[model samples]
Target chain A: MSLMDKMLALDQRIIFALMFIALAFPILSPVILPMNIQQYSRDSFEFADSIPSGSVVLIEGGLGAATYPQGGPGLEVQIVHLLSKDIKLVFFSIGTETAAWTVTAIDNALAKLPSGVAAENGVNWVHMGYVPGGESGVAAFANDIRSVKTEDHFGTPIGQIPLMSDINKASDFAALFWWGGSEGSIPFGIRQIVTPFGVPMTGMCTTNEVPNYTPYINSGQMIGIIGGVRGSAEYEYLMGMPGLALGQAMATNFGGLLWALLVVLGNVLYFVARREGGAK
Target chain B: MQIPMILTAVIGLLMIIEFFFPMPASVTSLNVTLRSFVTIISATALILGTIVLTIFHTKKVGTRGSEWYYSIVYVVAFVVTAGLGVLNVRDTTFLWIYNNMTSPIGAALYSLTAFYITSAAYRVLRARNWNAAVLLVCALVVLLMLIPIGAILFPPVVPLGEWIRSFPSGAGFRGMIIGTSLGIMGLGVRVFMGRQKEHLGIREERRDSE
Candidate 1:
């Protein structure tokens, strides 16, 4: 077979092995690639920063175990950012699994908080826990919190929590943050809270799902979006605290370069073979 | 069937009325109650699904059906997990199982997609025709645009990739959103009018025959 033919028919196992090396090498010894912050990430950061101190913001922690590493650092940083500025937070999750991971993110964030930041659980922030029933659950929780959730994620009653006293509905909060993370449920927040209650929102989703949501950002429904691990890294960078996501994002860059090279090479080989009349 | 259809209509209409109108407190209270029922019903449906799945696996195990060992695995996993969960979801062991075993497994499974996607891109992303070439180029541009090394390798890809994502891609997504919204509205009306009985689990004769 010709070189083009052989290249075009290169074993997929070889490609997989190459990809493994590309992804794993950076994780072992991370490379610091010069990166630009995406406007989406910037807008999301600015939106979070613009929320007034002491105003409560509602967050939908919709990231699960699979997505935690990608969106978790960003969520933690956002939590720290808000708590440091004295911006109280109320977190809830739609997925059963994600609710647990959300706790991990919150705990991590609280652990990393700068000295003397008020990290009170009930008084400053509260997690209403896994609200079931998808968009219906969101709408119900947005309209009347007490109806759906009687207690916080812990065993404490919602009524006993000081944060729940004045905050009853979506309209009560200053802004909404939906860390959707591949759930593709950003629309739930926008439809149930943003449009009906006029609560300005921002969100995060896996990198592949970014385009699925950019329209909402453009239309002003969502202020911005943090897309994937790179987004988490960007948020960490913008916050001037680099951590987990930055290293993962470097690995992602290496993987991307290898994938891009293979694609270009495959196409070049295809074109050459076609010109030589060696391909059908 | 008729009762469910009526309930769906009434509840849906009341929610809509509550959204767009200045409704009475009683109406608001009633809507709140109805919406809360959604959570309960959906939660119940989840339990029902689990019960059905358990039955299927149990039957498979009993009959020694195809790959029945997998059924045994499922049954064992479910029983152990559910037993611990019922005992105490907040138990240290339960949380440890989830955090250590479940969480890492979930992450590893998801990361496998990275390997699959890389191989797929190399093998399948060929410039076979005009449309294929356009898609390939667009995909490459976006891939380059997202990675940090792309800008260092070729600076112009940054702007070109940004434009493609912002304009063409954004416009296409908006169009899809609008189309889907209209389609959903159409389906909603059909469901409201009881012409769509699928949600109620009423299958058509032709569909069943096929």
Candidate 2:
């Protein structure tokens, strides 16, 4: 076989191995790459920032650990930013297994909070656990928070929970920031919260799901976005707190480059082989 | 079949009315009751699925056919996980198993997509025709837009990628959404009218003849 043919026919196992090394190297050594913040993320940050302090913001956790590496950091950073601003958070989850992820994120954010600031569970913040009815459950929760979930994740009554007293329905919240991992919760949020209640919404989704969300932002349905690990990194940059999201974003960029090179090389070889009649 | 169809039709109509008009207290209560019934049935269905899976795998293991060891593993994992889950669901052991065992397996399985996608993209992303070429170029641009260095090197690539995603991709997604919504509405209508009574264990032909 010609060199181009040989390259074209290169074993994909080798490609996998190379990709493993390329992805692992960043995790081990970690690179701090420059971030060109996207306007969507910036707009999301500014919108979140604009929420009047002391007003409650309902944060939806629609992700789990399977997407934690790529999707969790954005939630963590957003939690930190929201908590830091003294915005009382009422976290509810519609995705299965997201209740745990929500608690983990809240813990991470609380650990990093400034001295004297506390994410007092059931007081400053509360997790409503995994609501059962998916889109219907979300609509129900929007219509009557008490009926959908009478108690927080800890079994404390919504009436007893200090933060819950302020939030009776979706319209009572200053804003809604939903973090979507795999299940795209944006449409549900739009239909239930944004449309019926007129509450402004924002989202942070996994890397692959980011492209699908831009239309919502363009249409003014979504006020801002934290788009995957890259969006998470931009958020960290804006927040001035560099952490896991930054590292993962750098790894993602390197991984993207490696894939791009492989694609370009593969195409080049195909063209060369065709021209040489060693081809096609 | 008749009763289920009547029930479905009545509830569906009520839901539609509830959405459009402010529901009376009795209608609201009925709506809430119906929604709760759905949630309960959904949970029960999950339990049924678990029982079905256990039986299937347990039978596979008991028969001891070739490759039955995998079934044995599955049965054991399900039992232990389900047992732990049942015995104080918030127990540290259950959480540990979920975090250390289930979560990692799921995450690892998901991560495998990266390798498959990379290999597949290399094999299939070619300039075979104008359509293929356009897809290839758009893919490359979006991939570049995800990278920080690419954005820094060619700033315009950012907006170019955004434009492609916002217009072409968005239009496609909207089309899919509209199509899916119409299909769902059609299915709902069919089901409520008893034309889709297979799930109720009644054959359509038998019902139609009756």
- Top of the candidates by TM-score: 1
Q: For model 1, state the Cα shift of residue A176 in Å.
A: 0.5
Over B13-98, each residue of candidate 1 has an lDDT whose tens digit, in order, gives 88887778899999999989988899998988998999899999999999999999999988987888878988987787878878
lDDT of 2 by residue, A76-130 (tens): 8788788878888989888658878888888877888888876788878889887
The segments of candidate 2 whose C-alpha lies over 4 angstroms from its true place after superposition are A277-280, B198-210
Give the Cα error of residue B172 in candidate 1, in Å. Answer: 0.6
State the weakest 10-residue window (summed lDDT) of model 2 chain A. Answer: A65-74
Give the DockQ of candidate 1: 0.77
TM-score of chain A as modeled in candidate 2: 0.95
Which candidate should be chosen as best, given DockQ against the real structure? 1
